[model samples]
Target: MENKNIIITGTSRGIGFELALQFADAGHQVLAISRKMPKSLMEHSNITCLSIDISDENEMEQVEKFVKDSWSNKVDVLINNAGLLVNKPFEQLTTSDFEQVYKVNVFAVAALTQVCIPFMKKGSHVVTISSMGGIQGSMKFPGLAAYSSSKGAVITLFELLAEEYKESGIAFNVLALGAVNTEMLQEAFPGYEAPLSAKEMANYIFDFSLNGNKYYNGKVLQVSSTTP
Candidate 1:
């Protein structure tokens, strides 16, 4: 790596936090954005932790300011890892619940990417994390209605973006992740052990974030060992 500038959202904990650590350790200019401050993330000299809820459109402006002042308004890699999962049955799920989920998982992705597009030049990659539940090889688990739908939209959004920005040199892709043993997974499927840990998932995500788009464009990769 050539000391690239990297931006990773949802860095409060789990895979997002791990990604922030790896990038910072590699001597990259890493910006870790989340709603709350992660103490470990704040300690790294190469990592800048910004506490901003992506669902709030106004807060994304802070990213614009930070990029302008610190990175000269240019970024090499952008990891859109922030997500909100609404674990509720279809009958129990209210319209508000779905809206809230979309606000974070879907709309916020577009909002943040829009704000960051001005900073991205050629060879820049946009990697957004999706879920297997939204695509094939997924079991359509209970309480994942809103979550799966949002992820499905994510898959489509980046696919479209890949074409829209093809001439601009911005590569876009989605990683439809499986059950990583993160807090979110545990909350959804209590007492169930996932096949992979957050660190394990982070390793794969880090690799894809770096070079997966070199050959593939408008792609959605279902990252998991388990099959239906």
Candidate 2:
């Protein structure tokens, strides 16, 4: 494939980090966004690291500017992979906790996608990382009221966006992942070993983001091997 301009959020570690490295290694230009820039990503010539809180609206403008000035107003793929998880019992969870999680998981995804839409042309793909917990009929867990709900919200958001933008020929899809042994997972379920590693899941997402649009649109794929 020819070199494409790709943007991914939450690249400081885990699947986001692996996705950035994998795409860059494949000769694609990558704009990796995270709260902190990873040293390894900085060393890669194909990757450009941006340290900015996605929840901050003012800071998000920087992404648009970069796309216009640096990427020359072109974005082939956008991965909304940055997510915030708050693990607290329903009784103990505060309103602030819900806001915090939604700010990053739902609002940021919407904001970032809006900013990049102008630059994304026909055949471009927007992939949002969701959780199986977000699915309506999927199993639910304790202490995930806020986190799981926010993931579900984004799933619906992307589905609506896909239909709204169908005429534009840009595809929007959601991947509801089960477990992938990332830092977030450890926090949610301590000592639980996931069957898939970060790199393994990233590899799947990498390919899906590139070609899944051709076969599916406004759809949610359940990427999981285990229950809960």
TM-score of each: 0.97, 0.99
Candidate 2 per-residue lDDT over residues 5-121, each given as its tens digit: 999999999999999999999999999999998899999999999999999989999999899889899999999999999988899999899999999999999999999999999
Per-residue lDDT for 74-177 in model 1, tens only?
98889999888878888999999999999999999999899889899988999999988889546898888999999998899999999999999889999898
Give candidate 2 misplaced runs (Cα > 4 Å). Answer: none
Give the clashing residue pairs of candidate 1, or none. none
lDDT of 1 at 114: 95
Best by TM-score: 2
| C-alpha local distance difference test of each model | 0.89, 0.95
